[model samples]
Target: MKSTQLTSTVHLDYGLDTLFGRITKSAECQVGLEQVEHDPTRFALRVQPPIPQDLEQAKTVLVKVDGRRLNGIIRHTERLEDQSLKLEVEPE
Candidate 1:
């Protein structure tokens, strides 16, 4: 599939050992906010493949939404047949 421009970018840590750990990178596919729940500050994020490697294993993620940087943890990850990923996060 053709790559589309990402609306928002997320920076994920691979681990303390990986090269990407020191310098996080943006996701490869477009990112869209699906939903945001008020209680505990949880939300859903949609991303297309190729998904970032670190993202899959990341326990936490850093993202900018509406000009605000949010630090969140991955609650869940759902894989779609079309090679898209749905991520559920809870802000910390």
Candidate 2:
């Protein structure tokens, strides 16, 4: 499946420095993470398996991410060596 990029932004309770420190630590895990790109306005996350295998768990988890509330459920499958998937983002 081919996937397109969808985007949005969110706010974090933690300070930028602290938040990035924590995220950098978390990125050490080689499960679903692909890359983390930071920009002036927002953070771009490239992840695999765009749709979490468990929809309920994913929905609940995503709802709690940096106060994000996804607008829709989208599956973006990418045609690459890793076959990445980009999912829905909230709080635009």
For each predicted model, how many residue pairs clash, with residues at least 3 apart or on different chains? 0, 1
**Pick by lDDT: which candidate is best?**
1
lDDT of each: 0.62, 0.29
lDDT of 2 by residue, 1-92 (tens): 22224333222121112433522111111122222233232222334434333331222112223334423222233434665433332224
Question: What's the residue-level lDDT of 68 in candidate 1?
Answer: 58
Ten residues in a row with the worst lDDT in model 2?
22-31
Instruction: Return the number of clashes found in candidate 2.
Output: 1
Candidate 1 stretches greater than 4 Å from native: 1-29, 36-40
- lDDT, candidate 2, equals 0.29
Q: Can you tell me which runs of candidate 2 are displaced by over 4 Å?
A: 1-38, 50-63, 66-80, 86-91
